[model samples]
Target chain A: MDMDMSKNMERVMKDKQEGLEEWSTIIKPKTSVWNLYIKEIWAYRDLLILFVKRDIITVYKQTVLGPIWFFVQPILTTLVYIFVFGGIAGISTGGIPKPLFYLSGIILWNYFADCFTLTSDTFIKNQNIFGKVYFPRLILPLSIVVSGLIKLAIQFTLFIAFYVYYYFQSGIAPNYSAILILPYLLLLMAGLGLGFGLIFSSLTTKYRDLKFLIVFGVQLFMYATPIIYPMSSIGVTAKEILFYNPLTHIIEAFKYGFIGEGEFNGLGLVYSGVVTFIVLTSGILLFNRTEKSFMDTV
Target chain B: MSKVVLKIENLSKRYRLGEVGSGTISHDLNRFWAKLRGKEDPLSQVGQVNDRTAESISDYVWALKDINFELREGEILGVIGKNGAGKSTLLKLISKITSPTTGSIKAKGRIASLLEVGTGMHPEMTARENIYLNGAILGMTKSEIKKKFDEIIEFAGVGLYVDTPVKRFSSGMRVRLGFAVAAFLEPEILIVDEVLAVGDIEFQKKAIGKMKDVSSNSGRTVLFVSHNMSSIKTLCDSGLVMSNGTVSFKGDIDSSIQYYLGNSKNLNSFKSYENLDEKPGSKDVDLLEYKLIDKEGEVIDSFNLYEEVSVQMKFHIKKLNGKIYPNIHVLDKYENYFLVDTIPENEIPKETGIFISTFKFPKYIFNTGEYSIGLAVTSFPGSIVHFFENPAIIFNVTEDDLSLRIGPSTGMLPGVTRMQLQTKTLKI
Candidate 1:
């Protein structure tokens, strides 16, 4: 109750209108939500670099074959999918070489899956540091997206090698559209992963049982994502259902854009982009609010 | 007086306690039902939580309530409290690690808190890298961190190891390096919590000295929370003593320490049992409770320092009262044990229903410190049957002529009773 404090309090009270502020209060929540989406995360760019470096360093520490695991994980996963789906199940790789087809899907799908899984556990994984300090909480989930992108880049290099080999040996030309739309595809994957991850991260803080469900849920979600088989192989009714799968449009558009024989309607890609934007925006809002009071609950 | 740098008003934090058991969910539902209908919390109102056990099923308690205080620029304020007294919660609130459920806090400049040693330091990172990383996390700019990088290294006293991974450093070395970086970051407001409790005495001294320099040289406000009374007395200009989450006493360091010590000494009743578990150095025989009374058998608070104050003890000897004698000692506020007096065995009566002894303080010889009485009934000189050291009963010595000296001095001057000392004066 000093004069200076009274003056400061008056300023704060003036900034906060009483009756009319309620009508505009809806705007407050929305802005808090949108502010989290990209603006606050962009400010924590240095933290993103540090987290990316941390993720890379921590993974290879104490292992003899360092950074090689980055290449080995996607290669082994693609081989397993190709053997099971193409060889045993008699699935078609859409007339494209099986390795390139499987490698491409694995590369794109892993980025989304990795981002989703890591983002989902943002609150739980860093509970120790989060409890003791306050920074932009979005820095954590955004960093996960960035680090997963780095990993995707390394795996994508392997896919590039496969693409070159397939071009020379089997004479399949990668459509020029693939090069133009590559960055947008990356954004679509990041948006979807971040959206799903943040939703789960917020829910898991209060209901810890969701954390267990998320692990198995992400596994089941991968099978449903059409990574092993193209949407063209499903029956007509199932194909219609697959269109409702928002990620299907993005992945299908990517395949058609790159391999030229896959599905690539511009409107379908736009629908996928719109859905990604909505999820990313909503996820940021939920995440921003959750970070403010999570210390009390978590 | 300096300018105010940080202000906190009407802060409160509530915590739900003891709802972690098999049937807690059902109990919590019942309590919530009671609360919704304008009734008090069911468990808390009824005191249903068993007092005998350490755990309870109470619904909620305010860990901190209505805490208000301000800090001036360059002032070092120490927060002292017992366990469960919400000292850490206050620090966490000011650092903005957590927001208050109510109230507003405003700061004048960037605030950095060293709530834990080497917080956010990745073990895989080298010492040099961790300095930059932790510094940036504490709100220091990259250029600011780089500018002090050499000074931090020098203060940590770990040259050539700057390139070594932090995991390779010893725990003490890691703490030193972490603290060194925080000190050099040159924040406008520094918040530290019991991080100095780790490391050896040498490092503790170094950390304390560095904190002193940081507060004095840079004129940065510091909020320090510690359980160590001596450390608080040495470092803080003002102290805040918290009890049950409210500011109970705020003023000079001595007054706050006095308030804290006074709480521990419950002077409600003149009679109590000297339980060995409650007090140290107590053996078999039970010396129930003792009261400081006058010749009229009336309990009193102050003594003339020249008049004899009698402590009457009620006890029972299971075996023999053959060589029982009472030993008393006077301790100051800092717990520097001063005088020890022993009663002769020959003066005790054979029937031991009650025993009393009176010792006179000649003339207020002690300095300005909270003085507490300690009583011990010993069998012979070596073994103690019941002993209470530093009991809650506290008093202070007041004087008109106590000159504050700058440095360490040796010798006893003109006083009624001279405490034995040797003085030396040499010209440099």
Candidate 2:
């Protein structure tokens, strides 16, 4: 053992002329804001995938229903919206069936809500692992985004079942061309949620008051979006104010595509896309600045 | 002359002592304004010079300060220190758990930290799933974990319950599984902080052996922080002693331990009370002098590892009410009582007298450490103590050259004593 160690040392000493850049990792006092470490994120994609798997498989472990809770949550929320907004409040669904109208909006809205609330808690919840190991800190919030997508996919099936039922019974037709934009709509929602979540998670590390504001804030923000009520049913002033909320356009487009009702515009989708890009970029910048030293405050 | 794989330069970490909340935002704003004006961070000046004796503690502390060290490939360096000596802080900085306030920790290849086992484990997940999950968290690819999956399970000795949820496993099994995942991490540099302090002894031995194997076979560097001196002494190639946020000593394993132990604040090795009124004793008995002497009757402040030394305590018994049992208590530096030797019954005094009670230690008795003696006189039954002086005099037992003679003094000699046991050995 001694001889082997000595030989290794001798070889290392002989290579002392190697430049400083030969070191694989160089931890410095400050990391520049521009270097987002996107490649490192790709390198640890396996961990990100496994994290998403953990969130999905272990969410309801030991419970009899398991992932059935995923479908139940959106189904229950859709029923409540149909009763309170469609039946009691006499809100117009733009002639679309109540279940189909509510299910589409609820599924899209739930995805954003879940992603925002959970991603916002990234730092505080995963400080244990973050403090112990060095992986792309971005993986945590990304996993939340991906897991949210998985849930949306499962709930999308339930929404499709309602859409198919309504279509066969009443011969209602969805704009197939508008439905093709679903993938892009899903991306916008994830971007908005992840962007907002990262900013909050980073801020909450130092000041935890933002943590308590999240659940309440997300609920209030949902009311501002065109989820329960159709964009055409509300007053023009109300619709104009709600349009400023980027989620309004995304959810409206989602409703238009599947139910062939609610508001949809190319310019509005473009505006939401730009807002998501800004929020996600700024969020990534804030997250990058925070991940390096958040453990101290956290 | 081995190539250094890890080099740290001027590494310093300043921590906010109290609530790092909105109250500090004002300070941060002040620092930001100063930095904008090409001035140094105002908060950075707080810990530059530690006024340890100041009347009030500062709101910021330097958890580590200007630490500089280098680790060669395949070198296992043990970091030992008292709590709050910046040992864990050093590990934290190296692992990038928290960024340094100022400095750089440059290293070759991947640096993996086992700061704690099962760091990201979800209790509801099964062992098989946790293996992949934890391995991935530790930076192993799925295919890599699958490749070493069987080896990890075999090493952990938990093959029977691979599919069982981790919550069902005992705490020991959980630790074992966690350690197993980390053991196969195979990073260029591994930072382990007291992970071995848990788990059973057999597993600890296995882990220790595995570390030695990993370093020697793969030429990987490992930085281990543990309070267990024996483990450090046995496993590390060199040692670093930390004290009060700085490197106090860096040398071979044995001398580093010596420096840490001898650094204990015990200025005087002999204590004597010349004035009768100020003696450390009860009214009946007063201690005159407490000191250590060798077999040649020469006074010495420190004892050699293989030297025959005696602790002699002289006291004046003004008045005796019952049989007095003069005893000497030997304690390690941390005040852990090792042994107490009382005078034989026949040697006990029955009346008032000026008596010198001596307790002798045979050669090669004490291991290397700082020790102190407690003098007391108690009655035999129920040990009624009349007068006692705890830690009356402090002395150190330091090591000498191996030529002094021994059976075999290898990497470490644990325990407070090195007593020689006699036995008859033939074919057996």
TM-score, B chain alone, candidates in order: 0.58, 0.63
| Model 1 lDDT per residue over A179-283, tens place | 588788889899999998998898787678788998888778777777778877778887777776777877777777667657775776788889888888788
What's the residue-level lDDT of B33 in candidate 2?
Answer: 99
Model 2 bad stretches (over 4 Å): A1-16, A19-21, B46-57, B264-428
Best by DockQ: 2
What are the runs in model 1 whose C-alpha is more than 4 Å off? Answer: A1-44, B19-58, B265-428
Q: List model 2 lDDT by residue over A194-245, tens digit each.
A: 9999999889998899988998999888789877777888888997798789
Best candidate according to lDDT: 2
After TM-score superposition, what is the CA distance of residue A39 in candidate 1 from its true location, in Å? 7.0
Please write out the lDDT profile of model 1 over residues B1-428, one tens digit for every residue. 46666778777765655434446558769978998998876665332321222454445566677777878889999998777778887887777666675676667766778898888898888898888777766666667888889999998888889988899999999999988888886767889999989888898888888899888998988999998888888889988887667776777787677656645454421544332124233344556555666557665555444344565555555445457776777776667677778765567646545455665554445554356767777785566455554463455444333344323553333332323345788999
CAPRI grade of model 2: medium
Give all candidates' CA lDDT scores.
Answer: 0.73, 0.85
TM-score of each: 0.72, 0.77
